[model samples]
Target: MKIAITADIHLKQSKDEAPERYNALINIIKKIKDEKIDKLIIAGDLFDKEAKNYNIFDEFVKINNDITFYVIPGNHDVGLNQKYFTANNLQIFNSAQVLSFNNNAIKIFLIPYSADNSMGEVLAQNEQQLPEKWVLLGHGDYITGQSTPNPYEPGIYMLLTRHDIETYNPVKVILGHIHKREIFGKVHYVGSPCGLDITETGKRYFTIVDTNSGEVTSNKILTDILYYNENLIMLPVEDEFGYIEQQIQKMIKGWSLSDDELTKVRLRLKINGYTSDLKKLQSIVNDALKNFTFYNDKEPDLTEVNVLKDNERIQIIELVKEAIEKNDKELGLLQLTQNDVMEQSLHIILNKA
Candidate 1:
């Protein structure tokens, strides 16, 4: 049997970002329903803060009653037991629990977020009873070389160490709280199902675990907002136009958008470096891009970008700048313009020669 898993949704009501994340959730659920996956497991952080918008979640759950959402309390919502969050097809695991499937073939250990205890502490009793093939589901920090505390809120919450993984030895360890998708051997941080914040860039995915084959895979979930913030670096080459257009085209292709999804992309393009003609560079972007919303609903400004005159002259200028940069990289010795710095650098080189 195949099970779909996701976590760190951070669903909140009465917020500016409520719709963006909420719509993504709807799309994810719809995809699950369409795939005929009856069981959907949410590792944790289904709600953000103490925003007890139970009715909002309840309505969505009722509408999609066919799929059972097995949820565990995350650090943010550890007070879940105190809330009146009632919904059909939603089993919120508030304690250390286990769910058996496929006639005792697979056991999924659900360890909810706890402030006082570690994951190994909670699963100590089940250490001996761990089935040959089992999967662990939890919500918190896993202490490892790569594992870092939640950047948004830096603190230890029910930490999991390598010892925990070695002792329990679940077939797969899926977790939430870390917004970046990370993999350290069998431990997988499922990450945020969708980008909850603008800084949380990249396409998101929900993991799939096939109990029969003991294989874990991820299926990418591309949602409403496809945000691309890029620095379009310019070159001083004669054929730089092709290079500039190529970068823009490559970004468009990376989006993997169909005709319908063309309107979903939001681009924040910042042109830097020296171009043959600044206006020409801006024109190139205009000609290439069809219909993408510029960052702040304002067109990309290229007026400040440097204009290239002569390639040979630039190379000489660069060589001198490089030599001067070795001594004063930040130009901290004095406040000097481009000409002043280059003139001073030339004078020093002449004196040395």
Candidate 2:
């Protein structure tokens, strides 16, 4: 049995809100159909928020009418009020009840996000007799050494630890909720199938799990999406401006940036070496501003500037004055107020300038 597992679609009808995310999901479904995938499993977070917009849900039904989909409720899906209901052939599992797919060859188990009342009781009772070659599908945090703090749930937390996998021992445990892709033991987080926000920038993809000969083989399918890669480059004064321009160009080259589209670029430059002409850097900055539509230009405060040579103290002070003249207050303060050595030096420079 070949199964395509994805999560965090966050589908909404409004184009202004999550149009890219919705389009990405549509593209993925079309790809799945072309490949003739047998089963489709969505771990959770199918909707951004639990609001009744049947029109959006109806559009989802049209796209995925052919395939059999099994989904669980995510934190966002449940929200403050538990609004769980049925839609078409899509089964939304919100409790710990074991849903058995009684087909002869493949037996699938649908496990959704559990309430406090159900999780402990269900795990305690049925921890022993899990079906063979079955898949455990749900959305929750995994209790691993790499688990980080999440603000989605205030006090209550859910985790499928390594110990839990060893105990139940399903063929494959596919899950969601964690936005980044991760593989621990036999359990796999398909991550968000589409990029939801800037924090979700990376190679977003889905997993195809093949269950044949009682063993599961997983492959990743990359999606068509836009993601940002943030970089902080430090260079000599002569190379600083050129380096910044090059970085910006690299981000925009061969990439499609739509009008009124926003892409975040965080650039920090620490100039160390001497340059005969400081004004040359301005040309590079101007070029970047003219070429890029949306970006944030952040040059280091004076404290962050590194004086490479001990004898080049006078040169450093000159650079600090130039930075102040340019209204780079953060850099100016760092240079003047950081240490007695640079403070006294910059104090005299400021007085003289």
Query: Which of the numbered candidates is closest to the native, going by highest lDDT?
Result: 1
Q: Write model 1 residue lDDT over 248-294, tens digit each, in one string.
A: 78777876778656676567777755676777888888888757776
lDDT value, residue 309 of candidate 1: 79
Structural similarity to truth (TM-score) of each candidate = 0.79, 0.67
Error of 1 at 52 (Å): 2.1
Error of 2 at 70 (Å): 1.4
Candidate 1 positional error at 301, Å: 6.3
Please tell me which predicted candidate would have the highest TM-score against the true structure. Answer: 1
Candidate 2 yields a Cα-based lDDT of: 0.57
Model 2 over residues 208-229: C-alpha lDDT tens digits? 7665533444443344444553
CA lDDT scores, all candidates in order: 0.75, 0.57
Q: List the residue pairs that clash in candidate 1.
A: none
